[model samples]
Target: MCGKRIDHAEWRLTKSIVDIERLRAVAAKHNVKIPDDEEDYYRHLLNGLDATAQQVADLPEYEDPRLQIEPETLPRQWFKQKPNPLNGWSHRAEIKLPSPKDKRLDNRTVAFKDNVSIGGVPLTGGTTPEILTGKSEYPVPKIDAVVVKRVLEAAGTVSGSANCEHLSMSPLSFTSFTGPIHNPWARGYTTGGSSSGCAALVGINQVKEWRKRHGLPPIDEELGEGVDMAIGGDQGGSIRLPSAYAGIYGMKPTHGLVPYSGILSLFPMIDHTGPMTTNLEDLATLLGVVAGYDGIDPRCTPETPLREKVPDYSAQLASFKQTKQAAGEWTTSAAGKGLRIGVITESLAVPNLSPEIFKVIQEAISQFESIGASVSHISIPEHLLGPSIWTIATRAGIASLGMRNMPPPLLCYPCPDITPPALSQSSFDILDRHNPASANMVFNATLLQERPDGASLAAKAMMHVHELRAAYDRALTEVDVLITPVITRMHSQHPSLDAKVEDKMKPAIGSTLNTCQFNVTGHPALSMPAGWGKAEDGDAKMPVAMQIIGKRFDEESVIKAAAAWEVGGLGLDKWDGR
Candidate 1:
């Protein structure tokens, strides 16, 4: 019987193995080491399959007499809930327009992370079961998230919300609420999350299918014969990781450059909304619409408006094309007229990096040098605070928020029979109105005692962030732009569902260490695909992305630099090999 399924299973398994080995070979060439115990690893993989198979096999058989059951009775009032509005107007309207005549984006379908609310669609950040309820009880949001609204206005249709990590917290895309998002590029390896859905849908051509069903043109036709862009959000590499795994372009705009007023935030301080695309112009145009101040969000500053204040970006794009056409000297004069680039050595040395990432980074830097951009390595001694402080602060905030809103009993671990002991007393105590104050006191006390030393660590982390920012500023005294690998590793294998929590935490270090410091310091960082890496599976390719970090409010320079890289053909150009 197992042999009968072997052809189908082997076909699936072969594809997965090919992609996995491709990644392994890349890692090996770059000096990355994989665990040697192949049998043990396969055993672990099979165990997960066993659990899933058992669940499917154990499902009740309808004709079995012993399992026959009747529907349960319900209380009379259970069916009388008030009706919810199904098609109310959205709080904010999005603007959808075609690419401008002078400088057009290669029309590509773009998908948003669900965390960014669209007025009419369910707006779950992969958490809040209310958003996922098919009944559509939640009212249409009055306003769309700034990023969603902007993408639409910039000529991209609002296809649909992509699945995400619940509440945008987990690095692994797998969750109990929504099944794991598979990597279409490499079947067995996981697509990194919480932007997992956005990556998978676009990578697998699902976004194109959605667009076609909705009366939109295919991305290739939209992009004047080739699909060339995708857009998403980033809070700690949400955009970058998906781009890497999916083989595309992604950016995490400087903190606050893109207004995030209507988006669900994982951490208010670090959360940002940005774009991910297959090419640079799509990024530039999308940024134009979304980058502006909103009275609603105090974090938005009115000082910069690349869309309204600077030379027409479309026009500048034309100039770039003309320059290329004429074979005129490509000088930093147009974009970097005056700037400096710095590479952080500490980031490269981060532990446990897959060796392929190191090679990719080295190759990317070599590319930067060949492009006439001067490069030098530097250290932000204070950057050591990036990962530790961010974890403490973000987790404490989430824990506190949960305690405040959720009923006390809901916070405890599940129990099949009696209520769990930790929450049993609290649940009963809250039954009386008069004990509300006591409940508040208990929750507040617990929060204070348990809150991670974020304030202290952040303060220390901030000093490093500022020091690094100043260093970049000083470096800009001579050079034009800074470049570094967006992250040190490609997408890791899908984590085992049964693995211990410690194992889950290990893969995130590369993204957190290299990307989070910018959030702390408030600089604009762009992660553009730079090259391809081997996937653990042989048939698919893993992408390597590079970061272009620029001075505060200088997104135009960042966009321009990325565009040059794209035009120069330094990164993967298509979803499938051309």
Candidate 2:
């Protein structure tokens, strides 16, 4: 065979026989005495390496399961901006894939975050312009992602791709190239991200107004024929933050409960994808459709039971209705009776927490007593260390490692033929231009720092994460569920794009304050809107939220508690454009 180019990636061998011989010749030219035995030994090592490399090269190439083409049962319609309000559209497409006989989601319209692959279209993680513009060098997927396939089989129509934080790296939605998504409750206020668009689209008035602006007929809520749920990916707080800000129900299921096979993730351990919907019932239904083992994503915990083996969450909603608390007879109320709820004191004790938000959440927590649930303060002092742990793990463990690794053919997919989009120059350029100080800080302080330090930091963070998980697990033995404010603040106007990076980073600091810890521990958590509260120092009425955290794989307890809270008139089902 002709000599392979050393630089060609297909040639796996870095030092070939020819190159080894050249080294030997150069050593001889320098009069370096290589003993005959040593020379023969070096040649033997080279031969072994070459043989191993050739063996690998001769192995059959991997064929991605998703690349197998099939006849189209559903057609797709794409657009730049058709019915967008709130600046939430990254790209809009309508999907009508064929369904299985048990059509559970036939009445629902769902939107997916841009990171989730919708086969035959580019899966932009909110960074690649080529993908955004439909000029990606990669082949359009021939089959949908595992989650996308599951939703289709359940008869859910995909509305389109919702905008997200760039590379799903930032908690603030402003980082997306599509521009900051506006909160539906109040314009000029931000919709928290990286799953910003998912929650905003679920806003009842927001969707209605957008339809009117587009000259489309009004959404007949009576008929329930409109966007119903949105699928959101979370490394930290992407799903819950937006849900908290927009006043919708959002969940971050236990890690590995839902497959991350087709989602762009920051790290395999931290990645979670879950439902953001207007109601608990819909959230449960959508969760049922998406949560299951797909056998492709290795991040899924082996030996985990199938989703079918778990209790039907949709049916569990009715279990709450049968309780005595469903009626007004408090003396005989059986609902939430003997349920122990703990309010995480550390989450509320953040010094910057708005007084208005604190008061609202306190009042909401106080109501658990009315439903026969006992509430008390609980302390996990290490909870304050969550941000540091998340930073070290993601920046050191994921960012640094991702930089050195060769680009894969596709993210979270098995497609070998697709030329995955490179990390675009514009993505880095935007960060450099807009947040040079932050970029430099990340680059110099962590990524390019001494390699040993990076490794040590990541290792330490992981150990602390395990310790934290154990602490929470111990706390769960005392309390059935833990409660915290989803965010430190209630609401705020959007920050200016020209704002300093430090100023931009401060608001987002609290965005993941209470949420990221759960991501680290792989616990099931949900955000429920408590009620409307006045914005700090402002007249705008905005939503306040409380987070319910349950033990790992105990999503049923979390869901039941949330549903009971809502049924008791303590939860806000809609913002009502207040």
Candidate 3:
């Protein structure tokens, strides 16, 4: 479309589909008023443009450099089963790493969210294939997501794709067409979603580990081999919510810390992908591999560290462990002496915060003193406005871009092979019929676009994100990290597929209120398993989670703080009902 960037003849090319009658049809389609008298004048102009489009389409396409790999490297197959037992895996694979020198992740298994691309693998995106092609065939990506490539380069084995929410929109596991992802701790209950399968896969592995450590035999529900770690996408708490619900560790790194290239973007501003694992070391190790600038993602700002400059999170945690052990403080009160942890007062007041989880997190935060860390209550009033700002700022963009199959205006590699079908009323109804949130998001977008002052409000909200970021940066100066409960409540059982829209969406209310703030502010946030709480439906226990927020790009401090607490404060085992 850039006339100056191409041959002149492409723009000047003659005669096309529309002469006069066809032109009238086009104008009518767009509801444009064109004078009948001027039809001939406009006809020639439109023909030139149409010819130029054809000429540009005829030119050789530029291939993105990232896809160039050894031939036959991606030996692939389609998943025969629709929804597996845990309903966690979208595809199953046993991909080995290329000859990695460091071998940091040798023999470790990693699960990628279904939204992430892995060459030659069918990407369900947690929705049915019929929506896109009107056939059974799903789109198979030929490019590996940046994180997927990194994991393979580090000697990790790709376990397969983890099921996610439909359209990557819902925060409940129940919405995926693949079916409800069972909680590892309690079946039939949700492992909070969008990154539903990631959490379930990692969470199940943790449960297995606990059972093995206790010398207990595996139960029927503990049959499958889940992944050692996962790479999950987060726009508004997708990664953290599932991790929290599943009783594992998930970190949404400071925006752009991980290159989001090759992944289907939800919203460029809030889009993020990061590690979710059973423990800190794995989380740290995997993050270290993926946390560097790819130079293409718009989110990877100038502030992003280069690949070599990216901290070795595993090495950093190792050093902390060494220093503590050598000082005879490995499991003693001296471990967190220099750490400053702040509890955000406004965060606790977020509506829908469960009394059960709120109390557990309070008790957990108070235990920081036992490990010699200072836990102070910090007030950031702007935190309360984050949900509203994030909504007004992103709802329109997320809808229009997603619905019409338009990419954002960011400079990044384009996935050429995949073609998203334009949403027809039938397709829209198909999606809206299953998930109320999907309809709500699109309706909200239309509501905003139709309002005379809606764009103005969105613009102002975007501007204020900077203000919110600065407020947090100032608070972070006085504290190493800020802490809060992961959200207003814990994940609940799946609502029936035939349930009313209100009933289907009831559990997701306020789920993202606390988590979405960091997505907008671009701060790194970690969701760590805090403790076990009784499920609303029964006496069986489910995991409770707490949020740890850090200054942008400072993932090392956040990881170390979690490690310090697990090692010297209330142990993760104690939190897990050990």
lDDT of 2 at 360: 73
lDDT by residue (1-578, candidate 3, tens digit) is 33444344553454456777889988998899799888876776676677679888998766566754335355555554343678888888767655764688988999999988887778887777776445578887767888887888888888889989888998888988878888888789988889999998888888888768767788644436688999999999999999988889999999988999888777889999999999889999999988899877888999899999999999999998898889887675767878999999999998877888887788778667788898899999999999898999999998877544467897777554445565668767767667668768888998998899988989999999999999899999999999988857765788888888888888888899889999999999999977777776666777788899999989989988888887643334664453
TM-score for candidate 3, residues paired by index: 0.93
User: Candidate 2 residues 257-287, lDDT tens each?
Assistant: 8887756556777879999987788888888
RMSD of each: 21.8, 6.3, 3.0
TM-score per candidate, in order? 0.65, 0.82, 0.93
- Note the residue pairs that clash in candidate 2: none
Q: Compose the digit string of candidate 1's lDDT tens values, residues 30-121.
A: 69776655533443344445655777779843232211111221110111111111100111122234442222332435556766655545
> Candidate 1: misplaced stretches above 4 Å?
1-108, 128-140, 205-231, 302-307, 310-314, 321-327, 330-341, 392-395, 401-465, 536-540, 573-578
Best by lDDT: 3
Residue 511 shift from truth in candidate 2, angstroms: 2.0
Descending-TM-score candidate ranking: 3, 2, 1
Between candidates 1 and 2, the TM-score winner: 2
| Error in Å for residue 526 of model 1 | 1.2
Q: Could you give the candidate ranking by lDDT, starting with the highest? A: 3, 2, 1
